[model samples]
Target: MLDRKTFAEININNYIHNINFIKNKTKTEVIPVLKADAYGHGATQLAKVVENIGIKLIAVAFLGEGINIKKNGVNIETLVFNYATPKSIKENIDGYIYTIGSLEQLTELINFFGKNIKKIKFHLNINTGMNRMGIDIYNLDKIISLIKEYNINIHGAYSHFATADNLDDFIKEQYNNFISAIKYIEDSNINIPVKHICNSAASLFFPEYSLDYVRPGIATYGMQPSDIKIEKELKPVLTWKSTVARVGLLKKGESVSYGRTYFAKETIPTATIPVGYADGYFRQLSNKGYVLIQGKRCNIIGRVCMDQFVVETTQLNNVKLGEEVILIGKQKDNIISAENLASLAGTINYDITSKITKRVPRIYIEEE
Candidate 1:
């Protein structure tokens, strides 16, 4: 008996199902990424739901996120993928894992924790090809030296691919770089605890990239790089819905909404919904979006303003005030997937979930 609002409904069971799908896919282990607040589905709630589902590690993008989850009282090994401040690193080491990408950063960790550090877990990130984080491949020896000099526990050896999510020549080069770095590390006998490089796309489609454990982000929340076929069912955890605040009839040649972006050539009916870009519905969807209503798909009739938008429903009958509008989930006869929204905005699915504004209320639901 959870009372969900009209803005966002989180299907927790679907989220859990998606995680179990990935977990079973690996005969080995799975590290689910709960970063970006569980892809903006509320990290604390998601963590609690999946805590007992055999996830050995939970990862976040920043120090604050890790801390936030810690505050939630879930006791899984938390990893902050991005670099943290000295203060934040100490906090991460206090109860979670932090990433070590460079000797300079390693020195910062040592200075912050002092010799009091003991059995602190961290990943050694290799720049491989992304050149975004991690030590460069050429600095392998330096990184190894720092690993011991600082008494830092090597939890994992990780890297990021420049194009793992897309089909490109660069992926091959990045793969070579990743393999070379791993070989180099093994040759040095460092033997870091875990080895991983797969993002959601690579984990799902590129089996070759799955190493010790996959660091999957989007797919854990039922989203992949783009729309790709998967044998395992991935359930989308979040669904957006808002009530129709008002209903109206527009005569022929009547323009709807703020910018007059849509005009009706024939008399039609329109409904105003109290959701827009301010709620992370994406203003780009204005005059260009469709929502499922009464088991039928309806078009947006005007520009998506900050707090509201209009939908044309003349073709459909029996529409009324206070009816539910499906914005990001399957309705009776339609579906608006994260991939579907991302395609319209020329963005990634990750951005689509992360962009959801906090103003909207999130309600959690599980299988009855």
Candidate 2:
């Protein structure tokens, strides 16, 4: 079936199980990171699914993303973790929540809603070491004064870690910085309501980073953050699969695909899959990857092409056209983990999960 390969199977029940498990693990509030379309698991679908389970706050990266989530008719509080642009003030001020990291932006925000209900809740992101966003602590007092003068509702104080996924010292440094800022905000009489610094990495390995709340993104999808030893159980909730398009035998010395990247030593069997990099499957996987088919390892024997890739199934017999192929996920008696694919691509689990393009269809399977 032309529609079979290149589709992602999303286990909705698995995702729900993950959220419940995370809730049990820590006392902190859960903020599921739904940005980048829930790491390409389909944002609107995920938002609706998680909403039923009662996530108080859902996060997106930009104004349009928040708008899209809101437009979906799910009534959860949406947080824009990324900065809001000046042009988007109407949208931001009207309904969307904003995070202010720069004094100039804060000034703009105050001016936009001058003399209005200035108690609009907002978050202040402090830049401890991420070198990304946030006002330095030196200007914290000045900003606090501005916030008070404008009567802005200081809802939360937050920051991002530079290396929470790594070893102890780096996370400690960021944690100290975050806690110090939290103290500064709380001690300033601002009545800040929430303080959070944990991303996926921090949520799992660094408990100290879990302040009033912590946001877990990739880890909730059942992928480990930073290869650290994890005591908690996790399972990948997504899998990619396709059907074999064709199968043929290659004679000895016969080359396969562009550049003749791989040549068979003996007569071997091969299967062609109808998915390629255009489907968000990385092209670099040519001759450098493997997939599970019929519960056995199928090796890519040549350069991956534009719309299809070939895998040699020499060890196994009777692989035929239209047989199910698993690019990611478990098959009978075997599995080719997403981590293995990420390792082959020189990236991490986050990239692998997020890179699956929108063009590919997703099927939500209710896990039993």
Candidate 3:
């Protein structure tokens, strides 16, 4: 029984299924991206799950995230994707595999570690065409020179795909650039054992680029990365739910919520759910969203409040307090997915799930 009025249910089985699917598809090392708290599915918990499943490596966006995984007794290799600062490198030397994208960042690591720089290992981020935080292909010579000069240990090399999901011509361009960069490093006598550049989209849509390691972020959470659908099987791992808080009647012409945007055209029964924008339920869903109640879709009646929102419950056979209300999940024959919310909110699926605030507790379950 759930004590919290609003919470997210995480199906561990579904998560594992997604991971296994990606692994089987790629036929290579699968590095699950746990950044943004595993796309708001709870990183620490999922990291432990990954470790238990025999996966050797996981990736995060910050030093603190990687450190948190280490602190939780998860021994999997936590690779920090962001560039490391002097303080971060010194504070937790062994907790993370830092990503060195620029010559200056690499220089900082060498300066901080000094003669012991060889003891530290990092992945080189090559900027093919994203022009994001990475060592430009033109500057790879300088980066390679510095690594040789200090005898720095290079554990891996990687790049990001800006258009892998779109299947554009530029993906080939970036792939070719990454290939040339790796060859240049090897020709200079630097051995980077692990090489990867495919994200969730590329991992699914362009498996050839999976390389030695595939970093899947959104796909691991069982959400489609884009509109380009694939034949692979992926199930949603999270179900955001709430309970009917109050049942009441709104007279004709009665307004609901703060903005008074919804005025009832006819007298109708209404149910208020204990969820709102404060709980990561977007206010943009006001008057446009629907929730599953008693196996039926109930239209949101007005502007979503800070802690509660009204939904027209006339479609239900009967409405009662404390009844199950699904914000994102299957309810009987109907379902409310994050992608559904994202579409109604004028955003992508990533924004919908990742923005779910920390106020709501996550309950992990292993469904058969």
- Best by the TM-score measure: 3
Residue lDDT tens for model 2, 29-103: 888889998988888888888888888888888868878887888778877887776567554564556788888
On a 0 to 1 TM-score scale, where does candidate 3 land against the true structure?
0.97
Q: Which should have the higher lDDT, number 1 or number 2?
A: 2
- For model 2, the local distance difference test gives 0.81
lDDT of each: 0.78, 0.81, 0.89
**Candidate 2: where are CA atoms >4 Å away?**
92-95, 117-119
The sequence of per-residue lDDT tens digits that candidate 1 reaches over residues 31-91 is 8788877888898888877687766688888888878887878877787788778775654
Error (Å) of candidate 1 at residue 58 is: 0.3
User: Over the full model, what C-alpha lDDT does candidate 1 score relative to the true structure?
Assistant: 0.78
Q: TM-scores, in order shown?
A: 0.93, 0.95, 0.97
The residue-by-residue lDDT of candidate 3 on 1-368, one tens digit each, is 35647899999999999999998899998999999888989998999898899989999999888888788888888888997677777777774688898988877777777878787778989999999789987878888888888888899999999988787889999999999989989999999999999999899888988899999999988898767675359899999999999999999999999979989999999999998888899999999999999889999988988888999988777788899899999999998888899999999888999998999899999994
Tell me, what's the RMSD of every candidate? 2.3, 1.8, 1.3
Deviation (Å) of 303 in candidate 1:
1.0
